[model samples]
Target: MLESYSRCWTEIDYAAIAHNVEEIQKLVGDTKIMGIVKANAYGHGDVECAKALQKVGVDFFGVSSVDEALHLRQNGIHDSILILGYTPPEHFHYLIEENIIQSLVSYDYAQKLDAYAKEAGTKIRCHCKVDTGMCRTGVIYQVQEKNMDQILAEYRMEHLIVEGIFSHFPVSDDLGQESAAFTKKQIELFEEVCDNLRKEGINPGIRHIQNSYGILNYGDLKMDYCRPGLLYMGVTSDDAIPIASKPDFIPILSWYANVSLVKWIQKGQSVSYGRHFIATKPTKVATVSVGYADGLHRLVSNCGLEVLIHGQKCPIIGNVCMDQCMVDVTQVDDVKEGDVVVLVGRQGDHRVTIDEISRKSHSINNETLSDIAGRVPRLRRREK
Candidate 1:
């Protein structure tokens, strides 16, 4: 069994991913699922999370960078890795040789990849990123209108394969008419682009657009394949996006830290950097070995952040330092040193969710989890 000495570690439940994938499979009946393991599986451990999802029969893994894909390859993961983010021109050759699928949004970028692939006697399978409404890293609809044929004529080479067509929804979670209408427009545009390509004798292999929110709220968007990242860990920003098919999904990560030091302070005593938190009473404070440096958002300061100690809820006190935080365990009876503090998961009936923390910290759920940096160890949970 793997454990941590710092008392602070991320416990990843592989079974939860399996459970979530099963739910998604039932929802998207007949459609393939391209598991989005980008950003180290949204800080849920990429290699392990991808493997766990693979055990549940996921088709491919999606990442955001070449370095992330390379990490998986080095770890002996042979499953296909799709680089969803923009690949730099300098690394196009490396991307081709490594058998990693990349997204192409510019004609000039495609030409370089084509030249490299042809010289290496290999063909790179890439997806066309349509900037339907996201306005991010995709070919604009306006640009395509002016030079679709010209662009096609430039890179109509045998070494380049357009394997998939995808677009991103701007706001799939907001329950506003404009948000829904805009998302609908993006879906319509994605289809139009692919339809135009097919008419021009171009066959885009996989057609995907539904992200985590899209897969849940807009099932129609889950056409050829669905890419869901945050949902795999059992949370979604969009309440409309159903994940588990059950009442609710179980979060896959639990963050815990051991009580490093238990101390007492008189009333009016201040704690931590900038002396932000003061003792309201003769209080007991326990230092936890976790901070923003370990991916805990600094904005959580003065927020009603709670952690589980001695099976009881304790409020986090003071400004969170780079490597430590203080939690008030004064109300809890028999609380002593070395008791485990639940930072981001359940313990008994009390729990602290990543969504709750993210809201308090003024960030998104994905950023809250994926920001969990290194140094803090991760403990992998397996079923018997």
Candidate 2:
């Protein structure tokens, strides 16, 4: 039985990951894909997913920090990795040692990193981020000469190799007129920055502005690379707005647990903490070996969340505990301990998705998937 081996586990379909990459390749054509594998590949297992992605011809990877980049490197991932977030100055040497690219967030940050690289007698590869509208990081985008001057300074730094320039979209996923206009302006401003740099005789290395949403909506834009984080994982938020053209991306991960115990309760008996559920008549309750500690949100308790047992949807009863939750499995035929329980995946003709769990938990798909704890093992599988 599944319970005999593991209380809970995540099954990753490598074939599905490959399929999603192939679908994305078809959409973007020759534009290289920087497979975003940060946050443990959105909790899908970074090493495993990176290996799978590398096998499928993805030549670049994007991570959040130097540590994540090193994690990939230590795990034998030799692809070019770009850190899309901040890295402390003290760790600048690790970036050079590991041959990882850093995102130059601002002119001041660039100065500091360059100074450090100069002191170490080495040049660090970087991608300059232009704050085209998100207003989070990078040199603020302006068509004026001052904006160009700051960007140009990074390219001229002797210790820094400014190989690429990129920006992010705050609302490229939204097709609404207001949002579309904002997205369009962001693209235009980013392009203007790159064009201005080129006119100044700066190669600007590689220019990428599309994220997962950007690839779906504005893929026609010419860019050197496209960074697909969630799209590459084959799932989007449940509340995600409609896009121009939705690709047929296959989901790559499924969650499962095991039935730990089953019992019959008499009328008026309460189950779990807070006595939230009272049996009107005789009811059969099954304890599942997974809970909030396993990344199942506590807010989902008694919130109409269902699990699958013997291919039947069973309502989760009472409050979810740290390591276990109760399910009303009376309708399931011959429910027994050690039976497989599908938490976020298919069971017979029924399926529960990450978006479903996100909706019920009042969270987004990324948070829902990335919240899955590391304690639960991620086992790789290949479809026939």
Candidate 3:
């Protein structure tokens, strides 16, 4: 697993991913767990992580786009794949070819898809998304609402099949009581919609609304399927996971870089491209090969952000460049070029977690993980 062949790379633990899936399965009990593998599996390498979950019998997989679903199919992932977001009409054929489930967010999109499927002489599986609160996608759960059949009007029986109905909870993870009321209302609206659809003789096959935070906080609610996004990646950014969760989630990705060059700057010497970090004293600075392009936010420069070198915390000294950054390592003796530098994850007893990185960058784990550029190679650790 120690392939230091690149200036910057990330190591993904397959065993930890498998462990997360098993634990999530145990948490939700009989409810189907749809592993959300969107955004490259939250930047853990989508196909690799999905394969690991698939090996352990993951109930389903959710992706954000048709291209992502196609990537999984091309990699031989034949499991049930659902597009969590909308699929433009142009890419509708790809969905038909793979038999992947599409999400119907609007009546017009659904109608067009139904007609296209009818002409193709193929049936399409899909889930109807209801907008409980988050106004991004899905049908609004309120007035002007047409029943399921009316929304899906003229859908040839053989052309389109509504396999599930779902809604997204915008504030499900909020700890405050106010957010609680919002979540509850969202759930009630979704249920009411489902009931109205059923009364109208429309089948809502598998019902799911809970995301990672929702599952952690409200898994007991009714639902045929639960989407496990971040939690399945062993990243616990939610409050509920800490309060009463049994599973031990270990971060599966560790970012690393090599000290490509080492130089000693005189006292008062500025580091890197800016004078933002002026050395207070004569110090030895190590040029670690990682930068904003590799996902290290430039905002972290001079933020007292530290990376791990020789299991010691070394402060980032200046502006994070496009391909490199500098850190003061004068306190440590015998430091040299090509030493292993850890940007995230553990280094001996000292560790840098996604939480720490996110705090420093002023962003969430989702952005922190996915911001990792594609240029850096991902090293998958299978056995260990």
**Local distance difference test values of all predictions, in order:** 0.78, 0.88, 0.82
| Superposed model 2: Cα runs more than 4 Å off | 1-4, 142-146
**How big is the RMSD of model 2?**
1.8
| Model 3, span 1-384: residue lDDT tens | 476969899988877877887777777778888888899988888888888887887858999999999999999889989998878888999988898999887777778888898888888898878877887777666544534554445232457888887888777777578988888888888888777766767766799998887887787785888998888788866322233355777778889999988888987788878588887788898999999998888988889888899999999988999999998899877778888998888877888877777888778788889899999989976573
Candidate 2: tens digits of C-alpha lDDT, residues 1-384: 123348989888866888888878777878888899999999998888888888888889999999999999999998899999999998998988999999998999999999999999999999999988888889988544237789999999999999899999989889999999999988889888878888988898888989988988888886889999888789875545688876899888889999999999999999999999999999999999999999999999998999989998999999999999999998888998889999988889998888878988889888999999999988776456
Which numbered prediction scores highest in lDDT against the true structure? Answer: 2
For candidate 1, the lDDT comes to: 0.78
Candidate 2's displacement at residue 98, Å, is: 1.1
Question: Residue 80 error for model 2, in Å?
Answer: 0.8
Score residue 184 of candidate 3 by CA lDDT. Answer: 85
- Give the CA lDDT, 0 to 100, for residue 38 in model 3: 95
Shift of residue 144 alpha carbon in model 3, Å:
9.3
Better of 1 and 2 by lDDT: 2
Candidate 3 — number of clashing residue pairs?
Answer: 0
How well does model 3 score by local distance difference test?
A: 0.82
